[model samples]
Target: MSSAVSNQARPAEAGPARQPVPGPASTGTGTSGAGASGPGPGGRGPATDYSGYPLVGSKHPWRWVGTAAVALGVAAVAWSLATNPRWEWGVVAQWFTAQSVVNGLLETLKLTAISGILGFVLGFILALMRLSASPLLVSVSWTFSWIFRSTPLLVQMLLWYNLGYLYEKISLGIPFTDVRFFEVQTTTLISQFAAAVLGLTLNQAAYSAEIIRGGILSVDQGQLEAAAALGIPAWRRSTRIVLPQAMRAILPTAFNEIIGLVKGTSIVYVLAYSELFYTVQVIYNRTQQVLPLLLVATLWYVVITSVLSVFQYYIERHYSKGAVRTLPLTPLQKARKFFATHAVAPSRARSPR
Candidate 1:
């Protein structure tokens, strides 16, 4: 009777057992749940959906309209130029490759080559002098650059051409010395071509000196210090380390100057040196085909400048290797990529049913 009463009391004290809580993954609601269709580990959400869907691109109506407008404008200009007889396209073709024109072109190239070399060399020396520790050297360099840059190039050329009037003879000798050195007539020495070269080189050197100096200054001070610490000779440090790096800054401006120099050769026409422009002027004078001759000169200048620009682009690309992680695509590569991206494959023709 006591044991039966104890069992009844224990049954009355006991409560109902608890159920286990459902996890997010099991319930299909959290990151790992069945309903989650993403790109997460268990296909969590819409991100992981690989079902086929048609690709759609954004519309750019304005871009198409602008391109069409440009095309129409270009077409209209081309039509006008083609129909205009005043342009004398026939005459342009006639004299485009004439012997006189070819000779003039050669003269222009010769002037450009010689003047460019001399100008850059003198400019480099002036730049070094300007940057030197010696006050005398720096002052002299500064004064030379200042005077040449301040004066008009045309005036300088004219002055050089007429140098004989101011000084009948040029002599190389010690001042106040009875000892004689060779003396030459100023007029004989300062010919039209010589005057042109002197004027162009002096003027170009002034500008180029500043450009080179700016380039040199662009190099980091630490580079110079590091080279010095390494016990590298001054000349070696300058040529091998500093200048190679500085060229990255210098080449663009230098090439612009060169292009300008090519055209600046025309200024020598004032001295009666028969460069391309002078040749063109002479032809137009004889034929009275002024516009056509002028056009020929313009076209040749354009071609020469274009070639230099292309050369500049490649040179700039070469120097840019260390500055950019990846080089830019060449024109040909860019064109290929553009066509590949825009090309559409033709749809297959359906067979007759």
Candidate 2:
């Protein structure tokens, strides 16, 4: 220790500082070896080697801060929801699976299914008509969309329900002929259910026709022309080449319309048709539990939309093939990755220093 102090005190006595020390490569370790700090050919000192040191990760304090802020906000909202008495969550639970409510839910689902299927079918035809070269077909398709889209859905429902006033009877027969296949009073034909279906179907069709047409139009014309050059049948080109690609564009919007139709089904209450919303109205009217009943309907709608959203995500993912290099991870895969990363990070932090 006295000698080291003397060396520091008399630095001028030492000659010019030696060049940077050689690394482990220059100093042999196996045969007649010199250690990491041992001298090289010219007796050079060992240079520092960073490779032996433990790695340190970057820090992002703001990231943690933002995460904490969002977590606190979410927790506050959840707390409020749990503590609030006016939400009447118990009442929501009570009527949520109630027989009448369930029955009404079934009716809503039934209406949505029947109307959605028929609406898309009719819309497909209308889309074809709109896309066709014939002027009459185009005119008719455009007129149908315009008429339905221009008027309020409520008016349409009301008008359809009261059809008996304008048309005494609805008949299926050869036009300009006496021969009739079927005939019935308009009131008998357009019952509550029938009117509701008709209104929903026509309104849905009007929107869906545009959606399908837009999707079809989005497909490149160059591909269709090239397909024809290969002598593929027109029908085959449309179905195999065109429809598949068009579906990628169509499915998202189509599902949106279907979800909209689910909510729109509530509008049938105007006809006094007992769908979920109408049933909720009836219950609340009798019990004077308006907010709770509305909450029930809102929660049911949330559940339905949530389910539909999951379907939309997967369907969109399926069609995304070839469009993206790698498919996005599923919810389960993301959860696994998150846990794996954070779990390892904590274990590493707690490791022996």
Candidate 3:
């Protein structure tokens, strides 16, 4: 009787703790009362878990929208290609192999190679002069650069075409004296091709000077300071430490300018030079296959440009030492890499146990 009375007294004493848990008949929020939690008072409140809730986090709605837009654009282009009635694959194939077009391509390659080399050489010299400390050198370089840069390239080419009129003869003499040692008529001294080369090269030099200056400036000043601290000669510092790095930075832009120069060379048609464009103009004027000949010029440009692009890639890779962490692949190289990867992937997949 004593033990039973003790157990009954214990239950009454613990009633406050038991009140915290919701009874089977209760219907309420997880809290049992104003201050009590749901599971027995301190025995972990009704396990108020959020793990059962749906998971949500940051999502890129714009990325999905962009993907959809790209897909739609591709589909539209495909539809246009599929439905176009004027598409003539056969004619295009025939025109692509025409002899005139083939000859034009060869001529374009020659012209581009020659002009690019000459322009780069001349431009490099101008760039050095422009950066010289002497005010006289700077002024001379500035004046030359400004004259060429300010004047339209087309105007320059035309002026070269008619340069003979400006000077009947160039006399080698002392300044402010007619004491001529040797003289030659301008026409005898310079051919049309030579004149075109001079005009194009000078114009290209001006632009290249600016490009080179930007590259030189892009190199960190700390490099020059460090070279000086090491007691390196100024010329050695510039040639070895500075210029090599600057060239790497400027090569891509320089390559682009070279490509532009290649196209610009077509403007020499004004002088009736038998370059690729002149060839096309002559063919079209005679044959009147305007669109086809124009296509011929376009094809020639594409082939020559494509070849130069590959050359540019190799040149860029050569210069990109120490600075570039990883060199990027050319389009052809990337395609080759992809195919090589795919070829090995299947073998790797099959060899596994």
TM-scores for candidates 1 onward, in order: 0.80, 0.78, 0.71
Stretches off by above 4 angstroms in model 3 are: 1-103, 179-181, 328-353
lDDT of 3 at 25: 31
Cα lDDT of model 3 by residue, 1-353, tens digit: 13333444454334433343453333252333423334443456455443432222334668878989999999999888557644443444565666775665555566666766777777777778888898988888889899999999889887876677898887798979778899898877767677778788888888888888888988999999999999999999989999899988788899888888778878888777777788788876886666666766776677767977988888878788766788777778889986787777775543312
Clashing pairs in 2: none
Which one is best on TM-score?
1
lDDT of 1 by residue, 79-185 (tens): 98899999999999988899999999999999999999999999999999999999999999999999999999999999999999999999988889965588999
The ten-residue window of minimal lDDT in model 3 covers 25-34
* CA deviation > 4 Å runs, candidate 1: 1-57, 332-353
Candidate 3 TM-score, true structure as reference: 0.71
TM-score of 2: 0.78
lDDT: worst 10-residue window of model 1: 12-21
